[model samples]
Target: MTISNHASVPETIALPPKEFSRTLYAYVVWGGLALALLWSWAPAEMDRVTYLFSDSGNMVEYASGFLTPNFHDWDYYVQEMILTVQIALWGTVLSIFFGIPFAILSSSNVAPIWIVQPVRRLMDACRAINELVFAVLFVVAVGLGPFAGVMALFVHNLGIIAKLFSEAVEAIDPYPVEGIRATGASKLQEIIYGIIPQVAPLWISFSLYRFETNVRSATVLGVVGAGGIGQILFESIRGFYYGETAAILIIVVITVTVVDLLSQQLRKLAI
Candidate 1:
């Protein structure tokens, strides 16, 4: 009797039977169609740029030259680079200063419908414009330098900080906030004593992430004549001084890597 029961094994459904394999074929067909469309539709954007593929020799020569660099004018780089760091450091600090409050105001638990709705909308408007666009306009108005980059970083970081801080606020322990209200604590006191502590570390971690991002952004902003190593890079590309361009790129990679690693360490600590 036991053997008979054992012999009648439980039937198991295949986790992925033959029918599921058809999905892969569907993707294959979809991908083929996409490639065909891309090939047939030579985009207008591509037509505008002087694509290097058409001039293969020049591209090769430039890339080869970029492998070797002359850093004799490294002294000049020191001054301009300091300003870039300053822009990023200041932006990160200033953004956090004001953004934390907005985050609290925009969070549903901490704020009323009238406050949260308008504040969230305002944050959205701030985020709509890219940092580079802000820098471009400022460059035209304020003249070419770090000051314009500062203003650009400030506005962009403010929006980013606000958004992240609000999310952090939303994710906090609701029990604490509720408990504080029950004990006769005022709204401000409850936020100060109960809510802020829970999420402050996360806010710091987010700010560090934003700082790392801004450092990279600051480099690109210089390409549009804002300021930093990208200015040097832009000049190298224009003058066919590929060697200097390569050195600038190396420096940028090191800068970004260091900032990224430091942020990672901070994140671990915060967590």
Candidate 2:
């Protein structure tokens, strides 16, 4: 104690140097984002945002008409709504059938790079165009009907489902796959036994979610004469039958809500 135990004293430590590259990277990312927003502002017509407040009275008056919905044609609305659900169902089924193979092919872990790149690019092309555009084209090719709506939903959903499923495939635990390979199992057997089991739950969940989305999309496809409640909705709007339009919209909202709830439950069970 009298010696002060000078040899036991700890030395002060120095802090590590700050990473200039990380700081620079953060600044670059923020600067790019700022530039992008500024570039898009004028083109996006964001300056017209004030018009929403300025025209509030007109919107209020228009909305008031929807308050008193006419349910006189409820029977016909229900029938058309059922038809829309049917179209969505068929579209979702077809997409699931085709998406499985495409998903497998597009997965980097599952397929060669050559095959993955081309398949992914094709999927990108399919997804790039809106379902409405596909509906229009199919209507011209196959004539106006629910079939056009089904095809439109099929193509678009195929791209989405494949992308989602492939991601699930890629994220699977590699140990199971490696173990299967060690057993002298063929690649196909490894995928069938190891990969499919792991990804099946996610695939089912994805399909159910897409089915819910297809139901909503099918309603819009009727606007282009593809066939559904949307056709009736469009007619009501064009004829200025605001009350009927409101009723149709209410039915659509209720149906969508029910579908969403059911799909959510199914997804939970699947997971």
Candidate 3:
């Protein structure tokens, strides 16, 4: 028997002409588009950088005001901070309530295509629009207040929560679901007995996470007249109440940090 030294041979694969051409064309097209965008914006970008660098002292002066956060109107700042938390709490609760059903409807494994597609599209629309924009619209409709902030947070969070919950539903282990179905459980029963148990922890975790975000968003909504700490912050800035602004900043930071830590601990316990 002749021993062939074929093990050392390297196999070379050649790209097909069509595939090679397509790849080259894609690269060239993308590169050209990137270059075109850079060319169009380069001058303005350079000017912006130059302007910022040339007036760095003003930026430093503005930031320095926050160092000694004035708590002159501690009562008003605390009141608004509490209100922001309230708005976020209510928004998170409402979003979870509404989102659960939509989430079920949107899941491919749970609902028919007719229901899933429409529900998903609606969620897409809700998520596509920012909370600030929604807050603006609600302010126009409701004439400003925490109610508007709640509505904005509710709508936007619904979309996000639905998307997250649906994904959780879709990723469930099929064994429990099959067992429930095999036991002659109804569609709703199967989900309640199988799917809900599996995803409930995740859903809770998601809700808590969103609640934290909503707290921060509540402040921003206020700036747009939705009534929260953001409104106070906005006014302080506009009226150049740097000391009050600093105080509000301190309150917001402390509140958010404390809430974040609590949420983190709760999440750890949950899982």
lDDT values for all models: 0.82, 0.94, 0.92
Tens digits of per-residue lDDT, candidate 1, 1-271, equal: 3667555666885565567679889989999999988786676455645676878898888678977876766666656666677778877788789888888899987899899999988888777889899889889989998878877888887888888999988899989888988999998989998888999888878888899888888887787777776677778779977777777777778778988998899888877
**Pairs that clash in candidate 1:** none
lDDT of 3 by residue, 75-184 (tens): 98999999999999999999999999999999999899999999999999999999999999999999889999999999999999999999999999989999999999
Per-prediction TM-score? 0.81, 0.89, 0.85
Name every residue pair that clashes in candidate 3: none
* Candidate with maximal lDDT: 2
Better of 1 and 3 by lDDT: 3
* Candidate 2 residue spans exceeding 4 A from truth: 1-18
What TM-score does candidate 1 get on C-alpha atoms?
0.81
lDDT of 3 at 202: 96
Ranking by TM-score: 2, 3, 1
Clash number for every model? 0, 0, 0
Which of 1 and 2 is ahead in lDDT? 2
Residue 4 of model 1, lDDT score: 75
Q: What is the TM-score (0 to 1) of candidate 2?
A: 0.89
How far is 140's C-alpha from truth in model 3 (Å)?
2.4
Question: Worst ten-residue run, lDDT, model 3?
Answer: 1-10
